[model samples]
Target: MSAALDTHGKAHDGHDDHGDHGHHTPTGFMRWVTTTNHKDIGTMYLWFSFAMFLFGGAMAMIIRAELFQPGMQIVTPEFFNSMTTYHGLVMVFGAIMPAFVGFANWQIPMMIGAPDMAFPRMNNWSFWLLPPAAILLVASFLVPGGGAGVGWTMYAPLTTQMGPGMDLTIFAVHILGMSSIMGSINIITTILNLRAPGMTLMKMPLFVWTWLITAYLLVASMPVLAGAVTMTLTDRHFGTSFFNAAGGGDPVLYQHIFWFFGHPEVYIIAIPAFGVVSQVIPAFSRKPLFGYASMVYATSSIAILSFMVWAHHMYVVGMPVAGQLYFMYATMLIAVPTGVKVFNWVATMWKGSLTFETPMLFALGFLFLFTLGGFTGLVLAMTVVDVQLQDTYYVVAHFHYVMVAGALFSAFAGVYFWFPKWTGKMYDETLGKWHFWLSIIFFNVTFFVQHFLGLAGMPRRIPDYALQFTEFNQISSIGAFGFGLSQVFFLYIIIKAIRSGEKAPQLPWDGADTLEWTHLPTPAPYHTFENPPTVK
Candidate 1:
């Protein structure tokens, strides 16, 4: 690769111009193998995340199929357990987290006028770590006893009873942790150290700010998870019994440690979605983000509050009344900052020149549905209510609303919002609308009934159910299939857009205010900001 040149044909260190914009991009397979370019790495991350999405969706199909008629007609009870376990693990770690990281890789540098990530080689290493870790996770299922059936949480005593698959899950978690930590460090360094001459921290884009907070959340919380899982591994193999009551260790200790990590892990997935919505809402509304300073504070508060509420997930575990009360209030307190965010988004869109582009549609969908999820979560935060609903299908409905409808929808918004810049081509608007409507309707079809199921007494993680629960289960199953198939339509839209969609203008969205849209070239020069751009 040759040295990159600026728009004026001068490199940063005053070298001569490189031949063409694409001149330095290595040809053939080695391009992906050896490149340190953030765009290429980001593209790889996005594609990898999508592949895992499909794989995890397939697992979900198996699960829904087994639950369709309440008789275990498809998979065995054991396989059903494994499917549940890995489906959660894959969707969270493989699909959602990495998709955001991919967005960071592609956008952060451009957004802030940096040429590449601060630690370029380390960025490459971080992404490459995911595939091997993913392999360990997927390969675990083919082992003699199938994968860990202990659910993604891998609670302690249940974990100790697992087969070789547990070991693989442990390793995969460790590797994924390492990758996340490295990626966080890279994001922190790039945003902190590599911004243009005048781009101060307060002046950075909201997406950049969200990532900065998310990276910290990852750094603070991943180690706790690592420690919890490591103890589980020891109990299973070396007989340390860190969670064994016979060895004077309480299983509740694992819950404390895991949720300490798990609760923030929720924000780690969500804050970025918030960032995406922040960016998209303003762009479509033709207004500045309504509360930039407040948005930053709200995000920071949410991250801080995330730590205090980890115990909310354990209200049913027989903690003390005082402990339950404290967690309940702390959990509910999260709604303040969250409500601030929702208000700010609506205010940004208030009476502005709003347009219903594909991205804006998804962002609006996220706001409506995520708020519904939040209300349900608030209901669960009530200690008395949670005890009744814990481990039931109600719990399932709450999170899918937050995760699939919330995080995943915003992710789609981000992709559609940025698709033009990424490919320098417009996606088919008609097809995009079709995909969104189908997803919205089917997603509701799938999980909405589970709310009633939980209220009426249906336990989760069970292969079969009582005859009274059969009708809702069948409805939910059919909805799940329709939702899954909608993505196939989504995939086609994306491919068609990339191959032969209309050529997008340099600033595809007229409301965009960021440097990437204002200053960068269409298709974004393979090498961006070779000469650092002035923020003003």
Candidate 2:
């Protein structure tokens, strides 16, 4: 294998320019179905995730509409529960996870100078599994009892009592977990084995580092989730007593098992977001990341600690005081690594040539809001506090801050940072800023008040609220509507960029040090790094 010219128009890979590698590339719809190209597959993953985001967002709109005036204005209580259940499911599984995977599909190979994923066909299969799972999930809403009314947590006793919709949710969970495990396997294999010759373990970019860690977390945790759901399925039909207290089973045991997987799942959503912010902040600030090695260690530390803290979520279940103290302390330990990451990001930007481009703006939003979420999480980590706030809107507010601010905001930053590279066209900057500011303002308006509602004794996952909770719910609903609509501007910006926009420069940003910018073509070629580029 000979090397080729990198996007720098330099001989980073000493191969002949075998121009236009698309001869083997297929065309049209069948091409998408049958293709194994990482770029094509990544594009599919992104579109699918976005469609799910929209579908889930629509469900959110219904939930908010019902709560807008607290009188069952839009949906029945049962259907409201269904909306809440599937909304959480669709957003977490269908939206956030796939979005990160889509990024992995697109960037990981380019970042590591690998030709493609280690198992490209498995990569394709991993993505293809999601649609059926999503279909079953959505179709459950039309079934006899509507969708599962239990929350996305699907606590056992409630889960066992639901109708066929519960069964659909269980099956959907199994399929989704299978997809996650396969995707994790592919990522781990590629990151481990397929780096270009000179890219050592420590030499890879932060995004690669984060995914490598995230893949491990996925492999470790997804199966536990699968086991939990499988037990649910058995209890539903196979006469198993895994969670039925009437049959010598313990519902608290279900909570234990579920949170074991659930706590780690939080970082599974978050670590990749950390990776994105790590890349973007340094890029716009024109500084090397302040503590690259420390960043890696902190991330790993967080992943390690995630497994130890699951029971913090179950403090209300009357666990032994020793167990509660241990989990609470362990959960609090997660803050050390997370805070290190935040500090490093701040230090990287300190006294540097910081520019608030769309990506930077979003990254800043992520840092600020995510820190606030972290603080709330600390409060919730206390056994006594969590006992009070466990099922309230406070928990809802806490996670949305983390999930939306941490994951979704960073995802937006990533799209803006890389969109030019992906599409060969620049998005409208003014519109981009508009989207960011509106989203940030309205997002705070939405969830910020939920903290008050939770403290004021407003419960979550409920369709109607008492008169005392009325004004806050109304404010939150309005904000939700605004936040939801701002994403339309985002979609428009993306479509406009793809269809007709200014051509992007090969190096669109000023300070990026990664191979994707340093080596790849302006619009990255269909087949890249055919001959791996040796890292310095």
Candidate 3:
């Protein structure tokens, strides 16, 4: 964004009127292919993320399709296992993670009043890493034994026992890890150094603050995941027995290390959702975000608590009672800060002039359903409770709520909230409401029943089921199908909005106080602030 204007009052782009950017005349698809503009890159990242969501959602559709009946009537058990593994990896890495990066790329520059990300060339390189990594991941299915069937967790002994597909999966992880590390470092440096003159740490927008935290978390935890995979690779090829009990290595240790990374890795996928909600609720509620300082504290609190609770995920695998109790309480402590966040959202809208536009509908959906997910999480956090609930469909149900209903829903909320700004066109309001209601309703239907299926003693990772789960599974499958179908409408809404929808004005929502709304345009151009625009 522009520094304070000169006495003559022209926006400074760090260039003369006749400079390169001044006359650059933005045009070309090749510009997108080679451009390093933050807006362009951010848009690319968002679309790619959505594409991966569909790609992986297709797998979820398959899994639900197969489970529609009592037996493995569709794919083989091995292939079913591959679907789970590939779907998890692809969604976590390829979808949710990239979408957050997309948000950061799109917003962080403007939020801090900078014209572009700190290291533009490096931004290009980080994005380029994605395709090769995606190719390797997709290639694993064509390998002899099919893809990695060990599930996305890829716990050691099973992973080590796997075949060629494991090798490809490992390579894919390696490349993806490198990409993430590069992206994290770039984000940190950009946020640290790229802000405009007036913005300070506390003055910076909530989105920037959350991203700074997320970048640090990525740097700290992702390498641990890479190491865990490395050991798995070595055990498979070099004869190391890190996970082989017979060879004097403990498989459980791998779980400890993997989850050391895995658990926080989940938050790595989520903290941005926290940031997105923080942005949307205030914009639509026509109020300042309630407890802004408290929101920042709660985010940090959740990050710190995230590290401690990684062990909670390991509780069912068995730990000493003392350790288990400590983890149980520590895990429960997370609920406090999270509760603060949810309350802040509700309070932001408590007595305000709220409108149930598409964005608010999504934000509201997140508030109710994500809390339900959080409640289920707290239930599983108890030491005794987890023992009974662990590894069953209950755990699966809980996470899907948190991730799918919580994180992914928030993502859609963000997209709808920001679509006008990004597209310069208004979405079909009636159609958007339809997408939101059906998606939220069907999502709960799909996942809520799975909890009982787990409590009813259905184990996960099974291709076949006994008769007791028949009815709930049938309902869950139908819900999943409906949820999947809902997105087709979402895509239609977006396309129709872009092609022939109503128009959106700058400062689309009066309460959108962020610099992004004031300083940028609907369908913001290929480049913004090639010279700074004053934030005023």
For each candidate, what is the lDDT?
A: 0.90, 0.90, 0.83
Number of backbone collisions per candidate, in order? 0, 6, 4
> Candidate 1's error at 351, in angstroms?
0.7
TM-score each candidate: 0.96, 0.96, 0.94
Model 1: lDDT to the true structure: 0.90
Q: In candidate 3, what are the lDDT values of residues 1-536, reduced to their tens digit? A: 01101200122233234345544533355555676777667777887788888899899999998888888799999999999998999999999998889888878887787878888878877787887888998999997888989989998789988879999999888888888888888889888987777677887778788899999899999999999999998988999988889999999999999998988887887788888888888988899899999989998888887887778887877678999989989988989999999999889998888888888888888888889889999999988888888889999999998898778988898888777776667788899899999998899889999999998889888888998888898899999999988987787787777667777787677878887787766545545655565543
What tens-digit string does per-residue lDDT give for candidate 2 at 410-499? Answer: 999999999877766799999999999999999999999999999888999999889999999999999999999999879988887776
Shift of residue 425 alpha carbon in model 1, Å: 1.2
Candidate 1 local lDDT, 1-536, one digit each (tens): 11111211222123324555355755566667777889878988998999999999999999999898867688889989999999999999999999999999999999999989998899999999999999999889889898989988989889888899999999999999999999999999999999998999989999999999999999999999999999998898897979999999889899999999999999999999999999999999999999999999999999999998999998877888999999999899999999999999999999999999899999999999999999999999999999899999999999999999999999999999988887677889999999899999999999999999999989999999999999999999999999999988888898887767898888888898888898876767667888898886
What candidate 1 gets wrong by more than 4 Å, as runs, is 1-26
Q: Candidate 3 — which pairs collide?
A: 1-113, 2-533, 13-531, 424-523
- Please list all clashing residue pairs in model 2, or write none if there are none: 2-15, 3-13, 3-14, 3-15, 4-15, 7-519
